[model samples]
Target: MPDLNPQTVAALLPATCRKVFVAYSGGLDSTVLLDLCVGLPAFAGKIVAVYVDHGLQAESAGWGEHCRRQAERLGVDFELLTVDARASNGESPEAAAREARYRALRQLLAVDDVILLAQHREDQMETLLLQLFRGAGVSGLAGMPIASAFGRGQLLRPLLEVAKVDIQRYAQTHGLHWVEDPSNQSSDFDRNYLRNEILPVLKQRWPALDKTVARSAKHCGDAAQMIEAWAEQTLPTVFDPTDGSFNIADLSAITATQLNCLLRYWLRRMGLKPPSQAVLQTLVEQLVCGRCDATAQVCIQGSIIRKYREKLYCIPEQCLQKEVQTNPWIQEQERIILSNGYVLSRSIASAGLSKNLWNNAEVTVEPRRGGEKLKLPGRAGHHFLKKLYQEAGVPPWERDIRPLIYLDGRLAAVAGLWVAEWAWLSEADGCYQLDWRASESM
Candidate 1:
C-alpha cells in the first residue's frame, strides 16, 4: 500500500535473477504481493506463482484452485505442489503443515531464481513474542531472517517492512480476492492466539506495538551477530569439521555457561535448534567426566549427545534406522556356531593393520557393546577395550560407536579407531587380508 514499486523489489535481488518465484498461498499477504508484482512497472522479469497443498486442511485443494485462477488472471505461470503433512512427534499440525509447505516451495525454486514472500511486520512482532514466551536466546529472539536458504533456493521476504493493514489495503485496491482460512480465527494455534488475542491487548496500550516488537527483534539480531563473531573465534578450537566431531577436552576448558551458549549456538548455526539448557548441562557434564566403565549419553530435543574416545558427537537419534546393513562403515553382529561353539561375530571392517590379518584371523563380523576387552599380542591377560582406546588417544564420541572385531570370544581388533597389539598378524605372504574397510560397517 506504501507505493511498492518494482524498484524496491529489484533492489533486493541478485544480479543473476531475472525471474521471481512467489509462494502464492492465496492468503491476504501473498495475494497483496502477487497483485503488487503484477501492477508494478519496474519489475521486468517473469513472475511465477507457486501454491503448495499440504493436504492437512479440507479446503486446501480449493485454495490451490483459487491461487491458480488468480495467477492465470494476472498472466503469470502457476505451479501447484502437493505434499503430505505427516505429523511428527513433538510437532503440532500447524508446524508440520508449514514445514511441508516450504519444503515443497524450496524444491520448486531455482538457486538463482528469487523467491518473494509476504512475511510482514506483524509476523515479525508475533515471532518475537513467541520466542520470548519460549525463553529463547538472542539468536532465537532475532526472529525470521529476511533472506535465507530454502532447500537449494533462497527466500527473500521483500514485504518484511510492510504492515498487515498496508498489505490488505494493496490487495483491496487491486480488487483482489483471497481465500480466508478459518483456522486463522481459532485460538487453538499459538500463532492465532497472538494475532487475535495477545497482540490486540498489547496494541491497546502501545498503538505501534508491532513496530516496537520488531525494533526489539532488531536489537536481539545485533546481539546475536556479536555472539556469532565470538563463537567463530572460539568454535575452531573445540570443534572441527575435518575431524567430524568436537574435542571434548577443549570444550571442557570453558565454563558451563559458555559451553551451553557455544554448543547451542553451534547447533543453531547448523540449522538445528539447540537442546534445552537442562539437557545441554547433562551432556557436557557426563561427556566430560565419563569414567572408563561408564557410557555417557545426553538426549536433547532433536538429537543425542554421545561420548566416545573422549570426543563429543551430536547424532540425530530420531532419524537413525533400527538396523544397519553389513559393510565397512557400519557395525553388524550375529551369534554363529563354530568349532569353539556359538562364537559371536563382534564386528567387521574391509581392512586392518596388515593384509595378512584377514587370511589368518578367520574373522567373523558382528556388533559388540558393554565393557568388551581385547588381547594384544605382546600384552598378556585381557586389556579393557576402553583403556586401550584411551591409550590410543581416541575421543570419547568416536569410542561409543567405534566398531570392534572379535575372534571367538576375545576382542581381535578395533576398527578405524585402534588396533590390538596382539591382533596384528605377521606373515611372509603377499596380498595381506584387509581388516577394516573404507566403509563404516564391518
Candidate 2:
C-alpha cells in the first residue's frame, strides 16, 4: 500500500540539486523511477536518463536504443555510455560489471548533479543478507545508503524505503513499457539466485521481511556513522598528512578496537576498499609489532601498507616498481609528470635555484642512482645522498623514488629537499623552486 508517487520521490531530492540523472537500464525498476522523475514539475527539463551499456550481452546495443527511445518519448535527455566489464582472474563478473558501470556513471556527473538509482527496500534487504553471509563488519552490514557523495555530485536512492511490489504497481498503473533483461532470470548470479529462490521462501514466512531487514540495516548504518565520527576525530592526532603516514608510537597507544576502526576509516578515506578482518589483523600485527629493521608489509588489492622508520605508509603497488628512467625537462615546461604517478613542478620563489641558470642549462629528472652526491648551501663539502637522506629522516622506499633534478649532467637539486650549493640562490636573486608532489595513491 506504499505510495511510489512523484511527491514522495520529490521530497527525497535535495533542494540545491542542479540536475537529475536517472540510471536507466530499460528495466522495470529504472523505468518506474524515470516515470516518477518525469512526472515531477520541478524536475521537468532537468532530467536525463543515462543508460550504461556494459556490453556483456549481445543485446546491449539494442537495449541502449530502447532506452534512448523511451527517454525521447518522455521528453527527457538520454545518454549512452559503453564500458568494458570483463572480469579479471579470480574476480566476479557481477562485481566487475558493477565497478565498470559505476565508474562510467561517476565520470558523467557534473557538480551538484544528483544521480537517482532504483534500488528499493527488497534490494536493501538482499544486500544486508549477503553482507551477513560474508561475515562483514558494521559498515558492510549497513547496506546501501539512501544518499552519499558520488564523484563531485550526490547519489540518491529515493525508492529505498518503498517496496518492489509498489514500484511494479506504479509501473503497471502508468502502463509503462520496459525491456526485460534475460540475465535477471538466471540463477548463475548470486543476487539473482537470492532474489528468485531464497528471498521468496524467506518472505513467505516473515511477510514483513523487507521492512524488518531495512530497519536493522538503518540501525547498523547509524552505528557505523558513529564509529566513523570517532575515527575522524582521532585521525589528526596520529596521522601525518605531509607524508601520508601514521606514527607507530601514537598508533600503539590506542586500544585494539580503536586501531581497527581508525585503519578501516583511513583506507576508506583514501578511496581504497578495506581488507577482510583477518587481513586487517595481520596488517596490524606485522606492521606494528614486527622487528624494527624487518620489512613488514601487507598488500590488499593493488595498495600496500608498509612499515618504515617507525611510520606506517599506505602506497600503491606501482610505486614500489624500481625502474631507472630519465626524463628530459624542457626549460619552458613548468611540470613533469612521471610514470610512477609523481609530479615535479616548478614555481617562482626567493631562495631556490637561480632562474637565469635554470633557463640556460639542460635539465633532466631521474630516480635515485647509487652513490649520488650533493653539497648543501651552508655545508662544508659534498655529501653522499645516502648520508643526507639518513640525516633528513627520509624513508628507504622514498629515497629510491624521489625525483633527482640534474642540470647540465650534474645533480643540482634533490627535489624540495635540498638544492646543491652551486645552484642555491640568495633572496636578491630571482629563483625557481622545484617541488615533488606525490600521487593520491601514495
Candidate 3:
C-alpha cells in the first residue's frame, strides 16, 4: 500500500504555496488528511482547516463543530462556511451539494494558497467508472486531476494515488476519530450505489482493483493532456477570443474528429461545459454543413452556438435576453456600465467624433429602436442603420443590442461601428472614440 503520510503530501504540494487550506469534512478521508498535514513541520503555522457546511444533512452544524475541535486539537486555524445545497430544477441533490460546497470553497481561497482535498485512489476509480458509464470522453475518463487552478489559488489532491485502505490503516495506527456521514450509505446517489453495492462485489474478485483502475486513469490523463496541448496550439488559429467565435473557413482542412476536439476545447475555455457526443455531432452538422443562409443554432447547458457569416459563435444563454432600455451617458464619467453588463468607454483618437463637439454636447446611450440613419464619413448621403449593419456584416442578433450613442437626442455614433459624418473629425487635434465591450455572457 502507498504511504499515507506527511512526506507523501508534502511532495505533491507546489513549492510556491503560501498557505495550505485543508478541506476538513469531519470524515475518514479528510480527518486522516488533516492529521497528516498537522504532522508536517514546514506547514506548522500556515495550515488552516476549512469545514464547509453544505446544509444538506441535519447534523451538518454538529459536523462543523467536530471539524473545528479537530482543527483546534491539531493546532491549526479553523473556519466554518455554510452554503445552501438545495437542488435546482433537473439537478440531482448530490450534484447540487457538490456544486454549492465547491462554490463556497472557491470563494474562500486567497492568491498562492493551496486547498487540499482528500480524494484517494478509490475515489479516482469510482470517478473513472462513473464517467465510463455516462459515456464521457477522455477528459472525464482521466478522472480527477491531482492539481488544478482553483479560484485565486491552487487545488491539490495529495491522496489521489494512495488507496483508501492505506488511509484507514494510518488512521487506525494514529487512533484518529472521524464522523460517519449517513448519506454515504444511501443507494439513491449513483456514486453511493457504485461504492456500496457494485464496487464491493468487483473488489472481491480483484483485490488490487483500485490500483489497477488508477493506473488506467493515469494513462487516460496522459492522453488527455496531449490532446489538450494540441488543442491549445490549434485554437488560436481558428478562434477569435474577443468575440468568442470561431472561423468556419479555417476549419475546412480539419477532420470531423479534430473539429469536435476544437469545439470541446473552445467551450471549456469559455467556462462552459462541452456538449455530449450526440449534441456535438448535431452541432457540427447544422452549424458547419447546413444551408449557408440558414441561421443554425444548438443550445447546450449554459450556452448556445449560433452560425453567422461562416463563423460559429458560442453565446451565453443569459445574453439572449431583451436588451436594456436607453440610458443617459455622462461624458465626464468617460465610462458607463450597461444594466446588461456591457461596457461603453470613451477614449481619445485621431479620427472619430469631434472632441470639441463631444465635450460640449450631452450624450446618451440607447438601444436600437429601428428606423435610425447615419451618414458615412466619406459617403455622399445618409444611410439606414439596418443597411449599414448589413453592409458591415454585423450578426442580426447583435444589431438589436449594439449601443447607439446619441449626442443631445440625435444619433452621433454606433458604438464600435461608425461615427456620423456630422460628428466625424479628420484633421482635428484629438477626437472622442467610443468603444463598446460586450460582456462575457454576450
What TM-score fits each model? 0.76, 0.94, 0.95
Candidate 3 has a TM-score of 0.95
Give the top-scoring candidate (lDDT): 2
Stretches off by above 4 angstroms in model 3 are 322-324, 426-429, 440-442
- Model 1: CA > 4 A from native: 39-45, 248-256, 268-271, 284-293, 308-310, 316-388, 395-414, 417-442
lDDT: worst 10-residue window of model 3: 315-324
Candidate 1 vs candidate 2: the TM-score winner is 2
- Of the two candidates 1 and 3, the one with more favorable lDDT, higher being better, is 3
- How does each model score on lDDT? 0.69, 0.88, 0.87
Worst 10 residues of 1 by lDDT: 433-442
Name the weakest run of 10 consecutive residues (lDDT summed) in model 2: 288-297
In candidate 2, how many clashes are counted? Answer: 0
TM-score ranking, best first: 3, 2, 1
lDDT of 3 by residue, 1-442 (tens): 4466799889977777789999999999999999989889877898999999887778999999999888888899998998999999999998998999899999988898999999999999999999999988889999999999999999999999888888999999999999999989999899999999999999899999999999999999999999999999999998987787888876667988898899899888877777788888888888887866535688887677888888888776666654667788776688887776677888878889898887888888888988998998879898999998899888887887788988889899999989998988975558988898756455
